[model samples]
Target: MNCRTSLSSWQALTTSSERLKKQHLKTLFDSDSGRFDKFSRHIPGVLFDFSKQLIDDSTFEQLVSLAKESDLAAWRDKMFAGEKINFTEDRAVLHVALRNRANTPILVDGTNVTEQVQSELEKMKGFSERVRSGEWQGYTGKSVKDVVAIGVGGSNLGPQMVTEALSAYADNTLNVHYVSNVDGVQLAQVLKKVEAETTLFVISSKTFTTSETMNNARSSVNWFLESAQDKSAIAKHFVAVSTNLEKTREFGIADENVFTMWDWVGGRFSLWSAIGLPIALYLGYDKFVEVLEGAFEVDEHFKTAEFEQNVPLIMALLSVWNTSFLGHTSQAILPYDQALHMLPAYLQQGEMESNGKHVTFDGQTVPYTTVPIIWGMTGINGQHAFYQCLHQGNVIVPADFIASVEPQVALGKHHDVLLSNFLAQTEAMMAGVNEEQVRNDLQSKGKSEEEINELVAHKIHKGNRPTTSIVLDKVDAKAVGRLIAMYEHKIFCQGIILSVCSFDQWGVELGKGLANNIEAELTEENVAYEHDSSTAGLIAYYKQKRNK
Candidate 1:
């Protein structure tokens, strides 16, 4: 289907792609001595270096021109202005307003969202401080020392990722745990460790009725009741990050403990909202606000920076050029720092679940490829696992290599080794070893000609795989927030360029709706819905084998 917006960028980028096909990273760097300086830029807490990417000055200009043609600036403004950018859902994509540190008046349906945001922030701060100061008591007159966050998808991933990333900064008294899986093993493990007297459960479902979350919540409620043996204890032990007050009240949460979430904030993008209650409770409320401050700084940068210099816009343009123009179907996110181990999974949902759509804005099937598959692990671990394929594989995979300049905790040259590997991998990816170099090295080692000939192909790496290197000062709360927002804006800009509604996740809903129907059949004597032979056979066999 044809895009409703202008296709001028697509046409011009396609032409530019052909001309830049043979240009490699080595050539680009050699041609311009200031390649790194020209391509790299900074936000408040982070440095983004894209010199390793195969983008030259002429092609870079063309890519920037494409972003302008797609009206990325206007689309970005619409999102920040609370316009209904999520067309299919008819909701304004205003995750940005969740962290409006500037106290800017953003109106949604004639009501200012900042007022509600401020109210919620104050509420979160008070609640956290009360718990930390031993004012908010649990069932057995105990202060909270453990927090169990229960929810699935965005609710679970975002908070869990952030807390884990900032674990270095967390205080000693609080131990945060996350239970999102429907499988009882996860919750059981968490429950076995924490006592009802000291544990506070943060039930975080937007509707307060999500299947996995509610099931887990109910089980936890029953478990809490076992210890207290009184219904009133539930109020002291449970708080919620949900919008449905009636459901939360019914489940025994006090009204004051029910934090707010708005419809405009998508779950995947909800961390900047009160959905980050676990983060506040664990790291203290002030640190939580620092997270928002970091993200807001990037929001200002994306909103005001030119396409040529903007961090998010440059990221999106390079991604579009790699995937849509250069035929790469996947990108790797390799963080050198272990604190960011969850980043790949977090971004997998943030990007793929947003721009993975293949539908145009006018409700027609998209003819061209949209979002690429995003996957990776920590850089050092990946060096041992999948660096083989990345070095000498058939498919061209663009990669982002991330690290911090300063280690959070330095001990025994560990950070030095990690940073060295991080730098070497990108350099090796750009300028892969040739057969002659390998052969010379082998001969210098006194290897026979036969041995040299046999190992040459495996040792030769046809270099020029593109990579982006990003370094932060450190992985503090603000830095983590900045990194997350940078990618979020990149996703938005990518959607604008591709003419797809990045905010609405119809693809995820279709799967959930189908799962609901199949869930009903799981309790039936015989399956009712039509299915392929394999599915029907598997279900029938499971039913027959179960003794229940």
Candidate 2:
């Protein structure tokens, strides 16, 4: 039987969860003075403190056993070797190859992806340099001053998040805009701000046929032609990052301007590839390379680190321990830095979309839960919003609190206050205020017994909420890169342990295929098709509103 069915570690964790229910974190901390040191790890430029997580030494050892029994190391080796681990899609999960900074040869189907990645990097560097140096001209013989990147999902989110997250590192030489929405309002607003004379459009789509991306690209072309008034001028103003070279060339993007995206790299994880052109354009190619180098360093560590000391593996195991064994259904990712505001959302898609599966590799329905509903906002804001539920609610939501030790922008005492809140919140979650402590404070304040009795229930907080605090040395391009790669590896480990395919997202496609048919009907008032009762009623209501 598989580990899911008959693993000794699984039984151990199940029993441990039951036993720990009666124990408070305060008691556990009292038992070990060195819990923090024992539970945390300091990597190159980041420190991960999992001390707040509800795990003792025995639980940690069992998680390690889980990894060992699951053959995690062997599976990881298979992924790094570029084997077709994405069995449903028959594709190699090689996003690691995109940022192989050491120029190490990674073979996929006996072909070196590293060399191709280097070639693309060199091309991107050359092209970005030419544009930056005013060598690349727009349709009207002007240097490119603005860039509008058009793509959705991985193409938009990853690159946009990185660029926005690392805005301080940008040169401000170019104004970069992104339009991922299918709605015309976003595209129109972006186009209205930039003149066609000096603007460049980067139409990124792996297939060069994504519905939203192609629509936006076509609209952008029409918008540009309003000024240039020539179809031939399209080549100078537009470029593409797509594998469908034939489609891109037919669309008038020059051969040189059409970059590549391999099938081995999924869109959500393609920021290290040419999909990160906006990042390179705004922050310069060198900084972009720094991001790649940061991720590469983590790749090396993840590849070689032992299970006992491994960061990503430990994180994955903790997630499994919390979600599967402890019955927590959702995880919160609260990043403390303002620069990392997008971190939670980016990770939402990265984790949920990757590992949110209901079936095993052989299509057997899973008896246990897989990925959690990942949700959170900036740490301070979340304290005001959903942190209440995380603290006192019935659901046990394990969270990862990410913050930087050094402020990216040193503004007076702001960083200190942020850091204080960061440290305090995690501590508060772990060691909640008891009624005894609340009553002691109330009595010291000279509150009468009647007033104290009324307030006690509201003031009492049951602690032992689990958390992981990640402290980055600082929020730089490299640190952000390392941070993202760490989570990617964690998701990989998570899927492997859950007996699910992490790389395939057939669930996402089901909606898209349905929407395609629905779109055709929406365009024709008289046309209709078979539909569910709720869907049919909804469509009728929409058409009635439209006709009116």
Candidate 3:
């Protein structure tokens, strides 16, 4: 396969990127009165405005052409059709099947994955209902009141983010706590809040052998065993989401208590599968279904919508235009809603883990950058913290400003204040205050000419920073579902356009493998592994200090 850089559309985008770099975003808006109308798309719950981005109509069309040239449509179809697009893993990418609410029969390896997904979802619904309704009691014959969800990376982030985002809607029947860190502090802190008898542990690991998750699980079991004194009690308090039933069974969970996930579903995208059991258990199963329904809506739209009007496609195009073409190295995900405080962290893992590869599908090194460093916090906090660097920093960082029209909890003037800042930040970033404007404002405030001249340069903001604004109708379960699904498709489209394998995360595996090797050396004296001077010296120093 030819590199994407060799494509005709890629050359056109390269030229456009050079021309657009000299052009200000304010100039683009000034040249067109209908810029917002032309550059925005409206979905069911989202209004995506990219007019503030540094792109013209011709450039946008060329981006759409780039998508076509890369055969993005064909690739998308193969994914929806359950073909093995995850070539590295030799597995079909079928997280979409998990949320196929239409009940479509998606076949993979001669078996209907849609049927399998539906079966697993049924299990989650039934189990969640049993626990929430107080029918699934503890071994001590007491109703469960607390849930400790133990998993790391994708298993932990997706469900924890969803539960935290929608905690406002929870009825307080159960308190959900997530333990992902292997440091033991996070698990210990959560253990302080609930007793072993009334707390349910949902261990989510596809292989049931992820070092961090398994370590936390074992410690949790040890804590529980101290109270119960019988291994059989583990069956009542501990359930699992894993394909490794033998391992789960050996760990004392019953076979019926184990929910299965297929190899086809990548961990980062497994939230919609039985991995979302904690979500269903936290906020009744119906609400969890709403999340799936929302994502399914975006999936259908992603399939049928034209390349020009499709939001996720547009998102991918913008990312490529900014990163690979314009040479931006980082992007910020700034969510204005407090409910979405974890949004940035969740997307950091989602995009980075998926597309943070240097090589293309054929093992050739990609000529252009693949993925940006994804980072940010809630918008309000970021405004006070990093908006300074954003407004006047030497490096340009494109940001996605996300907000909702309705607040989850309606308080007088709070949402209004939040929306005002969200709107102003994007505008200020795009059309920055010039030296003249700053001088005039200072003059009006009764500052002398000396003061005005001295402060004007420092106050001047060269307003051409690119930002995309996303406004949701509300941040409910359905809207959260739509928001995440849109980004999920965006990641998929980005991988196809960049010619990188998005489904495989070998970089993460390399780190995990190294950590596994080093873990034993930490405990065994004189069992040293060869390393670079930096690593070897650090380990030797730690060992010497401990022996002292």
TM-score of each: 0.97, 0.98, 0.99
TM-score of 3: 0.99
Query: Model 2: per-residue lDDT, tens digit, 19-86?
Result: 98778887889899999999999789999999888889998999999999899999999999999999
Model 3 Cα shift for residue 98 (angstroms)? 0.5
Indicate the residue-level lDDT of 2 in model 2: 40
Which pairs of residues collide in model 1? none
What 10-residue stretch in candidate 2 is worst by lDDT?
1-10
Candidate 3 residue-wise lDDT, 87-159, digit = tens: 9989899889998999989999899988888888899989999999999999889989999999999999999
Each model's backbone clash number: 0, 0, 0
Over 1-548, each residue of candidate 1 has an lDDT whose tens digit, in order, gives 44723466577778778877877778777788898888899877788999888877778888888888777889888999999989788899999998999999999899999999999889999988998788989877878889999999999899999999999998876899999999999999999999999999999999997889999999999999999999989999999999999999999898988999999999999998888999998998988999999999999999898788899999998998898888899999999999999999999999999999877888788766789999999999999999989999988899999999899889999999999999999999998998889999999999999999999998999889999999999999999999999999999999988888898888888888877777788876555899899988987787778746
Question: Pick by lDDT: which candidate is best?
Answer: 3
After superposition, which runs of candidate 3 have C-alpha atoms over 4 Å from their true positions? none
Model 3 Cα shift for residue 222 (angstroms): 0.7
**Against the correct fold, how does model 1 do in TM-score?**
0.97
Error of 1 at 481 (Å): 0.9
Best by TM-score: 3
Evaluated at residue 20, the lDDT of candidate 2 is: 80
